[model samples]
Target: MKSRSQDTAIHALGIDFVELSADRVVMSMAVGPSTHQPAGILHGGASVLLAETAASIASEINIAEKNKYAAVGLEINANHLRSKRDGMVTATATPIHIGRRTMVWDIRITDESDQLICISRCTVAIVEKR
Candidate 1:
């Protein structure tokens, strides 16, 4: 499978795909100027982007190829827990639900110290491709 890291947005945000599987997707991004908000901390949008990317990729992999389906983000909610000024943040996404119509993913973002940075849940809709 092609890694989503190759996507321009992912590359621009410095996201790196670490692992890809049907059950889980792992990725990391550096908390540098590019990802920092006005407060010099990691931006919440960056976390959300990471969460959505991981969940979307995992959903695509889990869907049966015969179905010719693609996953699109239906909804996403993120809770920022801690703040980090620098260092890399890693996100791990695991399937909460994988269905024919919809898939839900639970993602947790952690700092270098393994401290919880953000928790997110994303829902993806499976749609048939034209």
Candidate 2:
């Protein structure tokens, strides 16, 4: 996998990659004031960001021509299954479809006890870098 840019949302949100493979990717994020909503629970938008970021990175890893191609998020939808006050949430992304033009990934966000917090499906488009 390539190094993540320092100024991106992933960095800003403190998302850390836990595992990386050809077929799956795992990432973790802290849930606190930074990711909390008005009620002090984990924000749905933050969960979506974690899912999409993991999916996008997984798609980028699958790209053979890194210099000529880039992976970008095409569409994403996430269901907030549960709410958390403060802790760590882990997201696991597995590919549903890996095609030439687009890749679909299923991402599941879990809490510390492995309970589902959010479920997401993300479509990533492989486009020319330029």
Candidate 3:
């Protein structure tokens, strides 16, 4: 399917999708010296970007026919449980709610070993084309 967001595989938000499906979505991005804020660990904004892209893809996949929704990121709450020095990070997004007006999703960012780096909850408003 064609992508709804005005972004490529990797976004200016530093989010990239590795897998996209009807029920689940996988997003990835690098976390090395270039993306760091001088401490050399993954940036918090990177984590949020991952969550946004993953949930956006899920919303795009779950919408009805002739319906298009742009993920406005109504709310995003993230908890940094751990940190990784230098490696790629993946975020798996799962559906929490798929109502007609709004949708919610939870995305967990992890390292290569499946170690939890951050957990996020995202809410997006689903609206018809104006």
Q: Model 1 over residues 1-130: C-alpha lDDT tens digits?
A: 9764566778889888899999989999999899999999999999999999899989988988746889999999999999989999999999999998899999999988899999999999999998
Give candidate 1 regions above 4 Å deviation.
Answer: 1-7
- The order by descending TM-score is 2, 1, 3
Question: Per-residue lDDT for 40 in model 1?
Answer: 99
**In lDDT terms, which candidate is top?**
2
Deviation of model 3 at 20, angstroms:
1.0
Q: Per-candidate RMSD vs. true structure? A: 2.0, 1.9, 2.8
lDDT of model 2, residue 41: 97
lDDT of 3 by residue, 37-63 (tens): 668887787788778778877887787
Q: Candidates 1 and 2: which is better by TM-score?
A: 2
lDDT of 3 at 23: 74
Looking at model 1, residue 129 earns an lDDT score of 90
Q: Report the lDDT of model 2 for residue 43.
A: 91
lDDT of each: 0.92, 0.94, 0.79
